[model samples]
Target: MIRPMRLVSIEQILQARKLLEGVTRKTPMEHASDLRSLHGGPVYLKCENLQRTGSFKIRGAYTRIHGLSEEERARGVVAASAGNHAQGVALASSLLGAKSTVFMPERAPLPKLAATKGYGADVHLHGAVLEETLAEAIAFGERTGAVFIHPFDHEDIIAGQGTVGLEILEQVPDVETILVATGGGGLVGGVAAAVKATRPGVRVVGVQAQDAAAYPASLAAGKPIRLKEMHTMADGIAVGEPGKVSYAHVADLVDEVVTVTEESLSRAVLLCLERRKLVVEPAGAAVVAALMQHPGAFTPPIVAILSGGNVDPLLLLQIIQRGMTDGGRYLKLRLRVPDRPGSLVAVLSRVSSMGVNVIDVEHSRISGALAIGEVDISLALETRGPEHCEEVARALQAAGYTVV
Candidate 1:
């Protein structure tokens, strides 16, 4: 049996704090009054989204790279990540004067890829997925004698990440439940070990994207289980299998693992943006999504970790638009009307009378099904809310146009 490394100790996590001192930010524990009231608990947010490299991964990367033997550091280092981890390792290795080769998936977000390269690491685009990219990194490390830096599987990495748990305990001493988004389980595993080892009463719950709920399945099987495929909008937490090292700690120390749906994740991201005025990536929002769906699970003070904020600008725009659509802020309706000058004015007047903001109006005579003298028009409007949307639709319907 290849026993996984259980070398991480509470003392190590505490020790890492000093090593990581002045390197990683002591991320804020934000008090979410709305979420706290809604969930009937004091909800504090560990805003790692504001941490160095825009994530908590910097904590682990810095700790691991700093602890490397001088010989190993001279030999260089290599790791693979989707984005945040890549930046962390790239920045850490650069700071330590170590050469770095970071392998990222071909379809990895361009902004992250560009940022990784910008951090002075040699960026290699390999494989169609993260798993294949990681495999390539390992092969490269073995061939060149470069030290392989495991993102969440190595003992030093886990201890470094465990520092986040330590900080959370110090910031929110009375916290009852801590929800962390889990991918390969590195962040939660480290936190779970630290929390369980110290504050044993605090429940550490790991939340995974439902599309990639490998940990829960692995737990059921009593071993790490690999998935055939993963499909989720929250790509950060889309690991197919738990890390061998992380799996052991999570299984032994984590209180429970839960899954959140794509819809919930999107809504949570939007809530963070619109209400909290914070920009959080989908993976980072998984913890909040889990809490929103599983209210009353925690008693007084519940802390959710906002893990990262490295979303692509394009994706963020799309998510915002989709969220607006879901919130009844943007609406599109196709209607048929007679081809006349007064037709548009009549529809516009009706919408205006209903206090609906007319963002765009397009009269398409070329695409839609039109009667001999009638034209189909597509109107995109912005409304106040659901009730306003309903009023807009009703007003358009009463104007004798065929509203679809």
Candidate 2:
């Protein structure tokens, strides 16, 4: 039988805030004019992306580790994470003079792995996914007598993460709706508890990646349900299940939980990069994605948390390209032209005349379906938007070129 869940209290969160003083940064809140324009109300970003260890994980990690008795501290701490939590635990343990052991997935990003180790943790690579890695870490903790530092689920962790909610309320007193990126529900649950206990009027929404969302089903069942498989580029929020403590808080306190598509996530990342000059990871951009995809779904004076900024550079490049394509700023086309030198020039000139920038061009005469006297040309063009892309395609077709 499942034990009754104990919800984190606002008083506990306040105590956690006192413990976190001088240990964590009060990350800034910035106005998002572009999101405001789309939302038709004031919008702001809680920039936890700039927090210590590059995420709010530090708040919970430090608070939890600090609560341990002296004897437990001497035993050290062990944790499992793919990225953010590992760095948070490593640094938190180091600051508190405890040895930390962190187990990460085999395919965890190189930058995150390096950062975790740099924070003085004994790093171990295990398993193909987070679940397997977590198993190994737990076993290690049990065998070595080290304290198992859970990334979420514990009341202390929830209380610690609740500090973000306190900071948000203090920063934006009149904020109506607050959107938070959700994975295992720790952050959202803590925020909801704090906000509800204090204001009792603010609406709190949790945003999850659609492909890996487990909260909706779990909430429907009124229990934490484990997913057999999960996949999403927003790896930070790709948890397979919610912890019981977090589930209790979410079910009781949060106003709503919503999911955003991968395409919208990419577009949100692009918007933060190009428009706001902020480097937000896909998970961190979930709130922005929700606002952009559903314009009127939220209330005015919204505060969206930018959960983390730890992203692989290679993945960033791919997301940017995908974002451009999804936003209709990039267009790819194949056309049939005469097998002559002027054919390429003619197409380029026609494209340039319409103010479209040609990113790449490929000409091939060898194709299974190409006629004897014809060549197939592939073009990668950039345009202003969807309308411009359509105009460019139509103009090419009208210029007597077969847009294959």
Candidate 3:
């Protein structure tokens, strides 16, 4: 049976805010005109991605570490994370004069590994996944008498994260709806508690990557349920299960929990980068993804919390390319053309005539489907948009080119 967990109160969150004074930044709320246009209402982004340590994890980490007794601090702290939480714990421990040891997945991003170490944590690369890394961290804490700082389970941590909700109320006084990117449910739970306590009528929603979402199933069952397998580009919110404490808060306070597709996430990240000039990670863009996927679902004056900005550059490049492809701005096609000398030039000429820019071209005559005198021409083209992509394909076909 699942153990009962007490919900975090607004008073506790207020106390946490006082404790975090000068420790965590009240991250800015930026109005998103582009998203506002889509929803036909005011849309704002709670830019926790711009917070210290590049995420909201610092708030909870500092609050949890600072609450530790002197004797507990002397014993040190241990944590496991793929990235954001590791840096938060490392920095919080350093600030609180406590030694911190962090265990990260073996395949964790290089930037996250470097950032965690940079924050004065003794980092250990362990396990192929976060679950294994968490086990190792717990065992280390158990054997060494060090306190294990959970990423998002404890009451203190939830209270600290709840401070963001308080700030949102102050920043957007008339806000009607709030969307939070959720992993183990800490941020969403905390925000829900704080928001519901003050403005009982305001709606609080939790957004998760569809592939790694656990809350939908868990909430339906009235308990936390562990996922057997998870996959998503938003590794930050790719939690396999909901924590008991967070689950309790979410069940009681949040109005709804929604999931967004990977395509929507990529588009949201690209949109933020292109329009808002913000570098948000996949998990951070989950709220925006929800807005894009279900345009009219959210109420007006919506605030979507951008939870972090710690994505790898390589991954960012791939996500941007995927976003472009999904948005129909990029098109890839193969064509069967005569193996004559001017065949390649003819194809390029036809494509260029249509105002399409070729990003890449591959010419080969060794395809199994190609006849003796035919060559396969693979073309990667950049177009204006979805309509332009279709027009390009139609133009090629109209020009007597067999688009394979």
Scored by TM-score, the top model is: 2
Query: Residue 65 error for model 1, in Å?
Result: 1.9
- List TM-scores for all candidates, in order: 0.92, 0.97, 0.95
* lDDT leader: 3
Task: Give a tens-digit lDDT track for model 2, residues 196-226.
Answer: 9989999999999999999999989878889
Of 1 and 2, which scores higher on TM-score? Answer: 2
Clash totals, every prediction: 0, 0, 0
In model 3, the worst 10-residue window by lDDT is 1-10
The residue-level lDDT of candidate 3 at 339 comes to 89
- Report the poorest 10 consecutive residues by lDDT, candidate 2: 1-10
**Rank by lDDT, descending?**
3, 2, 1
Model 1 alpha-carbon drift over 4 Å, by segment: 1-7, 336-340, 364-375, 398-402
lDDT of 3: 0.95
Task: Provide the overall lDDT of each model, using Cα atoms, as 2-decimal numbers.
Answer: 0.89, 0.94, 0.95
RMSD of 2: 1.5
Give the clash count for model 1. Answer: 0
